[model samples]
Target: MISGNRSKAWRIISWVIASVLILPIFIMLGSGLSATTELFSHLWDTVLPTYVLNTLSLALIVAILSSLFGVTCAALITQTNIKAKNTLRWLLMLPLAMPAYLVAYLYTDLFDYAGPVQRFLRTTFNWNSPNDYWFFDIRTLFGAGVVISLVLFPYIYMLTRTAFEQQDQNLHRASRLLGLTTFQSFYKVGLPLARPAIVIAISLVLMETLADFATVQYFAVNTLTTAVYDTWLGYGDLSTANALASLLMLMVFLVVLFEQKARMNQRHQSNRPITSSHEIILTLPQQILASVFCWSLVILGFLLPLGLLVLMAIEYASLEQIDELVSTGFNSIELAVYTATIATIIALVLVLYKRLHKDKLKALPINVSGFGYAIPGTVLAMAMLATFGPLDNYINDLAANVGIEEPGLILSGTIFAIVFAFVVRFSAIANGTISGGVEQISASIDLAPPSLGVGRLKGILTVHIPLLKSSIFIAWLLVFVEAMKELPAVLLLRPFNFDTLSTQIYQLISDERLEQGAIGAILIVAFGLIPIIWLNRNEDKA
Candidate 1:
């Protein structure tokens, strides 16, 4: 690698950009710390304990359920001779595209007393009054846990399945020679090997369960996410909201740190010798049971909710609704475009610099940007307001002192804050995608360029960009999809009277009018599929 004035320029620019992106978090921390103890005392006396307990319980319950469902399904598919596993393999991942909040709404409507299940139960049982029979309520914390777990179990399933598939068969042969049975081998040998993957997957589930807002909010569970929204938007108390956001960020950061540490120390090196895997031949009873169990999750998590949404759309579709949906769709796409483009550009620059630059601190920019991914969107939105509100005030004061017109809320009162917050939250996606692509590019390309007297900048422009075209497109599409579905961040950061598809759908959810916005919800779910499908296709090609 060659270093010169050009390298120095990029080094400075990289640090500046990374620092600017991370500045909001520091501002939020300052705001939270500046709050008087009176605010803390009030929150502690009223709702803080409830928020923490609900959040912890939700994460714990979801993690346990997801692990159980995912490990069983993965074992059925990978460790046993199950029927229709090829179909099951891809079907298992379909739930990833379904949002948890949508699942909550659909299932609530399906299982409530006013819904078909309960009504049918009451009618069939000849129950005239409430004491006649027992029925489960779908609006409680337990219900929220079940709905979120259904869609999230796929993370564990996918990772554990891959680990099970790739486990060295030699280990199983030794276990069998030592008189261990099939189930015994799985428990003693295979399960231990897949533990790291399972831990990582569970950590992901915990992070997502913590990030969820609409689902818990709809159920009135009072997690930190809803607390932030209620404190700021409902009560107009920014200081307490910032403090709660800071605590949430702290929790997410701890999870991220654990995952990173475990990942670094993981012992499953791919360099190990490959061996064929053994699939257990199942009896008829086992086969039937496994098939029923796996498909039940698929149907409940994806097919049922999706089918319900479609039915609602068909029954309620109208021109007036379509017109409003189109307008909201445009707003979502516009926000996605802005956020994706900026995030992708920053990711590309930072990733390329790390790969090409000859500096000990080349990793700093990427390390900084990746931290944002673990943060929940509501926290990020609070961070944005905390940072930009003061910046806007400073600019307005300066303008007045200089006898120029005051620019009120130019930064905080517009879509700029929303887009910027989204970029900060999602920049890690683009960074990871492009970084993987950059690694695939041969080092010889850079070596050959300098020998031909090509400057580094020209070589990057002419050579690197061309090679990274596919990755750039993929990164941009992922960020776009994420921004479109993002709820809490846009809901908090969007200007007055401005609505994206997410915020509008949330409004419909708040008012119990989801049927009217079913078409838009479908659109959001459909948009979410692009990145997942694309990632699968890329994985297939590789």
Candidate 2:
């Protein structure tokens, strides 16, 4: 009876947490749908069409460019006999650690007319005026797409490379036995098989491109993300911002649905691991070209941008900047700690309930909780405001009725809102990681505990907790890193005078003074790299 009561309590708690996480999203969507048509009409007549168009165009361009860069690089690394394959393989993933906005700012500074590249060009040819040579502008829509793809293509490259490496080798051998050459075999058999991974990768790129605000904002390219930010903060129109955020959320939902549909019928699994003999041998010229191609991605994506930041830090380091960095770094660490701890705990609860519970709806909480991952940070921020703004008002009203001192925006305007948003936004990461870990333990282990006279809660604490230590640590670290780097949600939800490393760097970038914040930017990048390095190490061990 006690075990049954405990299980029931766990289920109730899991559902309550899931509902709380999901409420903000539903409120935001409903609020937008129920918004006054006049606001919609005004937006439609003014800048709405342009924002929607620019958003769609950017997503398309990013998808195409990332597909080209990622698929080609993955192919070269997996299929061809590229020199330094091992080094290039992990180096390609390093770009994932570089944020898109930083790359945009660095590249623009480097290639702008007044910068060294154009100055070198003019000096080389003795050209005096702007009309002497036409330089490709790095501040245009296409340029934003390129800059974003530089950092994001690694998502595609990493997955697609794994797919290629895991493809059934027997199929390739059969193709070789037929009239197919190495390239032909890859095209006909390998590429077709890896289509699911490529599709999923591109979908991730699209979601990220849609979520992007700082890059497009810096480039003066209007998108829904920037529109939502402007509508809320620039104009102080929460209703209008909710409407815009809802629209963006709809786009992300479509992408998620499309990704699901694309993979619903696909099943590509293989027992055979790719071997050395199956690697395509390239001629000397082909070898150089492939090596150059792979190395160029690493250089342009991560190494060059990182080198620029290092140079800036060396040139512009100052005592005042270090003082400011210390303050903002503390804020970032504190915020990340709160977000990671809460998110990991929630993940543990939902995953464990699903694992041990006998209810038919056992999976519902975890499924609903993960939906936040697809919601962009801008949209999630709007959702938090929509949900919490009124709650804070109600609490204040109740406090006044009871003759208590009123709390001022405690939920909406304080760190509570920011931490809640972070947990909602990143719960999926923790869920997926912890769930994967939990799945590794045997089902019989649960029985063993009960058979040994251990209660469910005690068994979980002593047995499951110890076994999940590694997974729990990883889940916590991943969420911590993401929270430290997350900008949009925190930017919208932070209290007055509050700043984290990402926000501080974004402000410096906005004011064209990133040099002063170079050390902070490097710190953010270093945090971003922790998970990538961990992932690479695990892959090597596997």
Candidate 3:
């Protein structure tokens, strides 16, 4: 495949791009590991411990609760004769589109003491004092956990549901022959098979929980993500912030390790046909309970918050808000376009290199470049500053030496930085999508292209690109939506007076006035639903 000069150049270009993508991460780690002794001592003496403890606690609680929600819902939908099972399956996944932070803000409005719920209760009981009743504090760490679980549990539900569906029916049959009740047979034979997938899914939940910033920050529940953001933007200490980011990365590293270990330990493959499986028959009461549980998850996770946003938007909508949404919506769309295009191009380059390059070792660039998906935006923001800050200085010095005006923060404080960060963070989505499409194309097609006198780039444009058009579109759509909803990195990296939909919503949230941005919030939510709709369609086809 690497028979000519052009192929060799492609391989070189692929490696260079991969290096650039990972360069920020390496710089962040260097900054963290090379921190001043005083900074280390001060951090170790204060704040760091609290951040670590909060992060660990939040991750554990979210993971456990999300697992419970995911497992129970998966079992009910796939293994029982539950009411509305078909609708419940897709409804459960809608929450994944609702960003946890948005849910947090909306729920806080609904459940806050001054919100309608409390006002109604107070009027109903004719009691106006705090002692009149008790309400759960929606701003507490536990509250943050539950809000996160609502959005994140679907990760576990989707994966575990697939795992449950793929289990060998003969195992269930054997258990039934042993006189086990339907429920008992599933409990003993089914769950054990799904355990590894469940563990891996929970690990994904924990990783996302650890990476969360806007949700915990709004709730005043400080985790490592919020800490890193605060340390940089609040304290104006880049080194300390990078150190915290490094620490967060360590936690994520452990999660990745755990996921890998679970994957390696997986032993649940079965030869049985998935369609041959039996769904357990639920009693009337059990069916009712199951229906209520699944429906509640959908309501709280996606529908209720969405309805509230729509109401707020309707009640408070104005020409000014519409104008602002237009401006920020354009910003968001422009940013997502730039990010998706560049990341997709990078993904295509690297993936094609792996497939066509003679040296198998060239494939390493794909993994290296895609690593940023595992990184939190807050961490990536710190890394970007750590990397680009120095580069900006060098560029300024060079410009001054050449008798030209210094361009302050040309790379670090411009839209370029924001686009670069988005590409780094979301390239994995593009890579995975493109790789799937590329894998589906038979090797014989590559030979056909060459037999037709098509060279490397020509072959890609004529044969591969045509075949991959759908995948490229899907990849672009995924990255675009993710870039639109991404908050922390843009919150840090956006230039003065710049606001995308997410950053604008976060601003209103921080000011305790999400209603002002309700239109913007709903717009973001609507964009998030595009991917979910696509997934539902694909699942139906499957």
Candidate 4:
């Protein structure tokens, strides 16, 4: 009877936690869906159509470009005998650690007409003005897509490469035996098998493209994310902003559905373990082309931007900048610590409930909690404000009635909002990591704990906690790193006079003076690298 009551209590608590996490989103969506027709018409007549077009166009372009880059790179690394395959494989993933907006700012500074590259061209060609030669502008929509794809293609590359690596070697051998060339075998067998992974990857890229704000904003490309930002802060139109956010949220939900479907189909694909490695040997000329392509991606995507930041830091390092970095870095770290702790704890509770409880809807809480990962930061920020803003007002009113000093916007106007947003945005990471860890424990151990007269909570505390220590630490670290690098949500929800490394660097980029914030940018990139390096090391070990 005690165990039944405890299970019931846990089930209720898990559902409550899930509901609370998702409550803001539902509230925001409700406000938008029920918004006045006048506001909807106003948006539609003015900039809404343009924002929608730009958002879709950017998503489409980035999807295509990322697919091309990722698929080609994965194919070369997995299907062909690419020189330095091991080195190139990990290096390709490093670009993901470099944020798209930072790359955009750095590359623009390099290739703009007044920058060194153009100046060098003019000096060498003896050209004076615009009539000398046409130059490609890095600030255009297409350029934004390319910049985003540079960092995001790694998602595709990693997943597709794994799919290719795990494909049944027998299929490839049969294709080759049927008089097919290496390329034909790859196209006929390998590509089709990896299609589900490619689709899932592209869906992820599309969701990310839709979520991007700083890159599009810096490039003066008005997408839904920027539109939502401008509507909320720039124009103070909360209702309209909520409406726009809801629209963007709807789009993301579609992509999530598509990705889920692809993931389901993915299970039908061949997962036959590799018995032997069969690599297509490249001709000398082919080797040269492949090497150049892979190396160029690495150089352009990660090495160049990182090198520029390093040079900027060396040239512009100062005590004043360091002081500011330390201050903002503390803010970022504090926020990340809070978010990581809360998210990990919540993930632990929900995942454990799902695992140990006998409830019919055991998985519902975990599933609901993870929905926030699909949400863009901008939308999540809007959701936070929409839900917490009114709640804060009520709290203040109650405090005043009780003759207490009214806490001014404690929830909505303080770090609480930012931390909540981060937790909501990143709980999925913790859930996934913890769930993976939980899955590794033996089922017999679950019975053993109960058979040994250990209560559920005590058993988990003593046994499962020790076993999952590494996963818990990793989950905390991943959330911490993501919170540090997150810009859009923090930018929207941060209290006045508060800043993080990402926000500080964004400010400098906006002012066209990122040199002053190069250290902060470097710090953000370094934090972003923690998970990538950890993942790569684990994969290598595996």
lDDT of 3 by residue, 358-440 (tens): 76687799999988988898999888899998999999999999999999999999989889999999999999999999999
Task: Give the alpha carbon lDDT tens digit for every residue of 48-109 in model 2.
Answer: 99999999999999999899999999999888778998898899999988989999999999
Candidate 3's displacement at residue 375, Å, is 0.5
Q: Give the per-residue lDDT digits (tens) of candidate 1, residues 7-110.
A: 78899888888998899998898898886678678889988999999999999889899999999999998888899987888888889889898999899889
What are the lDDT figures for the candidates, one per model? 0.88, 0.91, 0.89, 0.91
Candidate 1 lDDT trough over 10 residues, lowest sum: 1-10
RMSD of each candidate relative to the true structure:
1.5, 1.6, 1.6, 1.6
- Lowest lDDT 10-residue stretch of candidate 2: 1-10
Ranking according to lDDT, highest score first: 4, 2, 3, 1
Clashes of each: 0, 0, 0, 0
For candidate 3, report its TM-score: 0.97
Q: How many residue pairs of model 1 clash at the backbone? A: 0
> What TM-score does candidate 4 reach?
0.98
- After TM-score superposition, the amount by which residue 464's alpha carbon in candidate 3 deviates from its true location, in angstroms, is 1.1
Let me know the TM-score candidate 1 reaches against the reference structure: 0.97
